[model samples]
Target: MAHRDRISNLPEELLLKILSSLPAKDVAVTMVLSKRWKFLWTLVPRLEYDHSMYQDDVDGSSRFSRFVHSSLLLHEAPFLESLRLKLDHYSCAADIGVWVKTAVKRSVRELDIEINSPSLSTPVLLPWSLYSEGCKRLVTLKLSHTTLVDTSSSSPASFTSLKKLSLVHMKYPSQDLF
Candidate 1:
């Protein structure tokens, strides 16, 4: 008798857990292992898109952008545990807002957005919706090398469940973020 394929027969939940531990790019690449894993990465709750990983390749930046767009569009997770984007290029301001909005709508618990578009004179403006109370479920938020345009006049606009917040090299419309 032939031995059963134990690894391939593992429960979907277990397989997803294993895949979640890897970087998002690697997780997506696992589709070639077998047909069973072709769409498994879409269920992962954590996603990290870092453009710096492709700095050596001439077309890496554009490819990275495409990967992010496709992954976000196809993700089937009910709620995202984390969404991280570290972009170092220009001409993607609009897409950034859409991505963040999607994550916010999914009730993401952790969000890390670091933009390094030094080629532009001004930093990209982060969507103001991020500061809205709808994102109360967010536990952690980190922003770097970006601009935040908060036009709200409310005092103490806060994230109710936020446990951590880090802002570095960021520009804010005002000093009322406290």
Candidate 2:
């Protein structure tokens, strides 16, 4: 069936439900299908931009980075309830921090960052300033598969609404995080 015919038959509620199931990036691209569906994305309440969806189990660095950029930069997502990210192995920790901070600044209730197979260097460690930027509204923060840095430069965000905090695959001295 043609694009117009198919969409014309579907109800607006159905379209919103289907778009809600997909990531913000996919929903943005769906807009090009027709003008009637252009603003359908704005009604979606949940936005999930998990980069792990691009994991090929063989090579994922380039693919994941591009996916992340597309989701964050190309979409029209507004005030997401939660931001879930799986940082690609080859990506710099600094970039991940930037993305998280952007989400928090937008009033995200839950921020989850999952890293897989991280790299280490003399000067390359988790960016501590991400938390120092003052994320008072963040309710839940989860950081996984990362190298926790010595946070001497700044302390963790006050995180007043934070109730469920989880850290996974975090490689750091016990005292560093304490």
Top model by TM-score, which number? 1
How high is the CA lDDT of each candidate model?
Answer: 0.80, 0.64
Where is model 1 poorest over a 10-residue stretch in terms of lDDT?
Answer: 118-127
TM-score for each predicted model, relative to the true structure = 0.81, 0.68
When superposed on Cα atoms, how far off is each prediction in RMSD? 4.0, 4.8
As for candidate 1, its clashing pairs are none
RMSD of 2: 4.8
The TM-score that candidate 2 achieves is 0.68
Deviating ranges (above 4 Å) for candidate 1: 1-5, 55-61, 117-122, 152-156, 173-178
1-178 in candidate 2: lDDT tens per residue? 5444676469876887787788766876776666787767666545666555655436534666666665565444556577777655566666676676666656677777776656533223544434654666677878877666576663544666778899876777655344
lDDT per residue, candidate 1, 65-113, as tens digits? 6778898999999899999888876437777888898898889999998
Error of 1 at 78 (Å): 0.9
Best by lDDT: 1
